[model samples]
Structure formats: C-alpha cells, structure tokens
Target: MFSKACEYGIRAMIYIGQQSADFGRRVGLKDIAAEIDSPEAFTAKVLQGLVRQQLVTSVKGPTGGFELTPEQLRTVTLKQIVVAIDGPDILQGCALGLPQCSAKQPCPMHFQFLPIRDQLNELLRTHTIGELAGKVHDGLAFLKR
Candidate 1:
C-alpha cells in the first residue's frame, strides 16, 4: 500500500493531467488539493517531491503553480510518481515490516503479498498518467473524494 503522501501525489498528478488536458491551464496547489481532497499543506509538501523528481513542473510568480506538459503526462508512469514520493522501498520492502524478511525467510504474508506487489508494480509501470486522466476526462473513472 502507498503512504498517504504517495496516494495524494498520484491523485494530484492525475487531476493535474486531467485539468491540463481539459483547459490547458496550470494548476495551483489549492486547486490541486481541493480536487484530490487532500490537505493543502500536505499536498504542497508532496508536490515538492514531485517537482524535485521532475515528475511535475512548478513556477514561482503570481501565475505560478504546477503543470505537466502533454508529453510528460503521456509518459510519466505511476511507478515514477510512487518512487518519487514513497521511494523504491515500496517495491522491495518487507510486506510485514520485517527488516530481514525475504524469500529465504519469508513473512507469513510474504507469498500472498509478493504476487500482489508484483502485479501492482507491473500495472503502475504500464499505466501512464495520461491514460488514467483520460478515464476521468471521459467520465469513465474518477479520483475519490
């Protein structure tokens, strides 16, 4: 599972992509947080990581905020966003939080969780922000409130 920050970051990214595609507008942290139903402060912090990772772009002036270019929206995978916010530990950390858990000495939930994690990684890697945002744009999907 993703941390709240990671979850919010993903939703914010997808929402930004949707908004950009809809209106060709740059989005402010306030708008992004409202759309994603996250706290403004937390969303701002999460966005900083995204900006640092180059997963999203930001500006500083009065018209300043965040926006993803069309090419970026089309190519930025969930994996990149997740890694930016959550680190690669989501891919390799122990399912039960055991520091040493692994195939050699698996946790009780290890086998059950491994396949699910693998599938999640594959899905994240394959699905771009553009694809998910398209679903929102088309009314076929939504980000939870």
Candidate 2:
C-alpha cells in the first residue's frame, strides 16, 4: 500500500541504521542512494521530508550530507518512518474511504479489516527501527533478480 518513495524512505532508514552503526558519522546522500538502489532525485526528496520531521540530520559541508542522530534512531519507529514519507491518513482509516466507517456504521469490509488494521498498527507502534532491522536481519532481504 506504500508508494515507491515510502518504500525507498524505509530502505534509506534501514540503510542509515546499518551504516551509522558501522561508520559512526554523517553519511553522504550519494552513498545512501547507492546503498538503497534508488534514484538520487527521488531519494533526495524523501530524505528532505525525513529531515523536516527530524527523523534524520543533514549537513552541507565537505564531510556532510545526511545521517541519523542517536535520538532519531532510538526514538523513531517504522510507522513514523512510513508516515514521514507516506503520511498516516491511509493507515488510520478505511481503505474504501468511507466517511462513516465506525463500529456502529461499519463499512462493508470493516469486520474483515478492523482486526487486521489494528494488528498492523500495533506492530508499527511497538517495533522500533532497531527491532525492525533485527527482524529483517540487516541485508538478508532476498529480492528476486
């Protein structure tokens, strides 16, 4: 349900988590884009949004571009990362866009979706970036060629 920008944004964060953990400095945008295998222009825009939300730090000098702060890494969650790029509205409401989606005025798929949405939301709420990385196990994602 997420956009390419949102997917890249998440990949960028996970990239930062692993890189910052290893390199211990502000990472360059070029490196981040390369690591995540995304286009520079698009990733730049996504990274800008993350910067505005304080989910990442940016620098302009010779040794600077972007990096995750300690607090950002520890405090940010998967939902926050997704929201920073994709927004929270979709994840918070009925996919069908019903105005009166509620327990009393339930949407057609409310019964089927309510529990699923709740679980997904809960997973996002509880899972921190580090925890998510641990589960994904850092570079173990097997994408088909």
Which candidate number has the best lDDT?
1
- lDDT to native, each model: 0.91, 0.78
At residue 89, give the lDDT of candidate 1.
Answer: 87
Give the C-alpha miss distance for residue 33 in model 1, angstroms: 1.3
Taking the tens digit of each residue's C-alpha lDDT, what string does model 1 give over 27-119? 999989888899999999999989988998898999888888999888999999988888998887878888998889999999899998899
Candidate 2 regions exceeding 4 Å error are: 134-145
Compute each candidate's TM-score over C-alphas: 0.93, 0.87
lDDT of 2 by residue, 37-134 (tens): 89999999999999899887888999887777666767788889877787887678885778779889888898899888888888877777655544
